[model samples]
Target: MNAIPVDDDSLTWGVPSRRVAAFFIDSFLIMIVTLGFAFVFAFIHLMSFGLLRGPAHLVLLVGLIYLAGWMASPAMATPGQMAVGLSVRRADDLGRATLVQAIAFTGLLYLTLVAGVIWLGVALVTTRRRAIHDMLSGLVIVRAGALEPRPW
Candidate 1:
């Protein structure tokens, strides 16, 4: 009697075992840096008699946050990621993403967020356990100093 072979697809990727704290830490750290840009924009608006203080300010803040998270993710990863032992990397390439690449990811992430369900799809997928924004940006959040490969 011949036996059929089986293939396990779960071994292809890994999801970091850390709890949500790392995600929050990375987000908060990026936001703090982005706030600096917000303040500058705010101050400039203030000098102009509050012309840009409301909706315009909010739009600028969101954009600044995206830019900060994308561009400085690697820099912040050295420390902020070190704090939670998590780091961000490109998914398919599995290497340090360039600043421009990161920025592009941020822009695409905004586009992906138009529908809330897309984010859910990202988190639910079997590939790397990332959010839709991550998928759109070609990025992954992984353990920083981990040595062993995950069995997925």
Candidate 2:
């Protein structure tokens, strides 16, 4: 099999293991935020004497979308990606991904529940180490600063 490049000059794709670690970190962070929102909602529900079911799920969904967009913005990377020394970029220009790509990437991730096994298999075998969501959004996850010459 051909080797994947990791030199300072070439596009240094993030290692699969690191990517998985990043995923877990991001998930945990998201969960924490969701839980916080749930707590607030729960309090509100109690105040209402259980008349309201609460919008924890909706808040979580919106929070996730906001988080993804913020992370993929030109100026920043997600906290988890930063922790893992990784970042997301546009596949074509190696620049920071746009908000649209960020949203689409996050939305596509939900599909993984139904087709995630296949998606994970593809990610494992792909040359660039990108998952289905990455491909669909024309984005790539790479070592942080791997494409530093270009504007973020």
Candidate 3:
């Protein structure tokens, strides 16, 4: 699909608070799903505690992949983002982000424990309001339906 020029003036960048809320929402959903998988695994193999360890990790990994794929899809947002009225798109031209971009964004987010503080500080100070992952992936999270067509 062709990238369309977005009217910068009309674009409303998602606030940090809203973005944080979305993160928590997504995290909670992922946790519930992982726990369900763990419970099922434990039930299926009552004697094999090792089943929980391996399957739990695999479930989390699959959840992460699902999250990335959801973000990269044409919706350009996850369920959390959708609920919060946020969508992620390429910063260059407000185009939908590719799967690679979505995966990188998710991976960098997991690194927040190590580099998040620094990145958060940078995001707050930047005019574009992009977090580290967003900056690294050339993505922007904006208010859903906020993008407008630019005048020729």
Candidate 4:
């Protein structure tokens, strides 16, 4: 994807609090959609095989689901994000980076979910209020169509 040129007037980072609110809504929506999609796929696979798959297969499948969402969602220039006035783009305008980079970031995100939650804390403190995954993925979530930012 070509980089959306960041002009001097563009927000680039410091997006307002409302954008953060919209991000949460988008995230919840993605969760619902992805899970629904995964379940349907899993059911079909299960029925065809007439046996339950191992946890490993399920984990791989789920990872693929997320990766596909991550890749395809942004394929539209913007995704559910743009619909709600947000965009996900690389920090350095390096295309979409790579799948391995995205997966590694996701791994760190899940690992942080284990006990200490340090990465979660990092997300809370981000300049644009990006989640750990977003930061790691080098994607900024910003208001899509608005000119001026909402009041702080």
Candidate 5:
């Protein structure tokens, strides 16, 4: 993978706004996935005399896991983040984030959602535009393609 320009000021420019957009996009995608699963599960639920309702709820968990995997993939961003030209990186070295970090970020992100989205407002005031989960996970969201690979 190419090295990211961690030192460039432009790396974080407009991140807060882009992140907001990405949030909506990702949410919609997740909703679609959930609905699709729900539809199939509902049919099975009927066939199985309502015994499938419990497993149907697992769709949410699967969606969360998928989101984390996407974030930790080589692309370094979720589908929504990629759509908005944003990427996640390690806060300490701007290196690609590990799967562990991505899972942590995803879990905390849902926690923030449950606690009220006001937590996201932190990005507006933070120097790096990081949300609470981003900070806790030691990751930063930046404008993708803002930094070119350093010829090392």
Candidate 6:
């Protein structure tokens, strides 16, 4: 993806609060989806007489992949992030993030959340309002529509 020139003014405005709200919204949505998957997996396991072991164990991994997939898509935002007017981009050039970066971001984000949620405090001190995962993955959270559309 070509790097897009983004103004800090457009990228950082009111993002922190929007991020918090997006987190809650995403978490709720994830929970609902996970529950649905669990039920399906349970049914499969029963039908197989417990021989298949089903896919219950992969739920968490699948959730992470789903989040990463969204981050790397043309939309560059999870459903919740899109709903809340936020997008994720490469920190260095404001380009679309690769799948690897998105996966790293998703993994690190869960780790940060698991680690007492204190890591998020770093965003308060950072100039760009970026969280630990955002910095580690070389990604940034910006306001939706902050990036110009690709000409292609």
Best by TM-score: 6
Q: Which digits, one per residue and each the tens of the lDDT, describe model 6 over residues 48-127?
A: 99997746798877669778999999989999899999999899888899999999999999999899788898887887
**TM-score, one value per model:** 0.54, 0.79, 0.80, 0.50, 0.88, 0.89
Model 1 residue 129 distance off true place after TM-score fit, in angstroms: 2.0
lDDT of 5 by residue, 54-141 (tens): 8887887865777788888999998999998998999988889999999999999999989999988998888777889999999999
Candidate 1 residue pairs that clash: none
RMSD of each: 7.8, 5.6, 3.5, 6.2, 2.6, 3.6
lDDT of each: 0.56, 0.71, 0.76, 0.53, 0.87, 0.86
Q: Please report the TM-score between candidate 3 and the true structure.
A: 0.80
lDDT of 4 by residue, 102-151 (tens): 55555665566675655555645756566667666666545455334345
For residues 12-103, write the lDDT of model 3, one tens digit per residue: 45457678888789888888878887887777667675554555456658566867888899989888888898888888888899989999
Listed per model in order, the count of residue pairs whose N, CA or C atoms clash below 3 Å is: 0, 0, 0, 1, 0, 0
Total backbone collisions, model 2? 0
Stretches of candidate 4 exceeding 4 Å from the true structure: 1-52, 55-60, 71-80, 115-118, 121-136, 146-152
> Per-residue lDDT for 23-122 in model 2, tens only?
7888897788778878888888898888886564577485457557666776556777778787777877666788888888887876774665567667
Off by over 4 Å in 6: 1-7, 148-152
lDDT for residue 141 in candidate 1, whole number 0-100: 62
> Which residue pairs collide, candidate 4?
85-144
> lDDT per residue, candidate 1, 1-152, as tens digits?
32211122232234444424544565676677667767787787888897766644464456545544544555434344456566666676456766766676666655665655445455656555777666667766665444234454
TM-score of 1: 0.54
How many Å off is the CA of 151 in candidate 3?
Answer: 12
Look at candidate 5 and give me any clashing residue pairs. Answer: none
lDDT for 44 (candidate 1): 77
Residue 98 miss distance in model 4 (angstroms) = 3.2
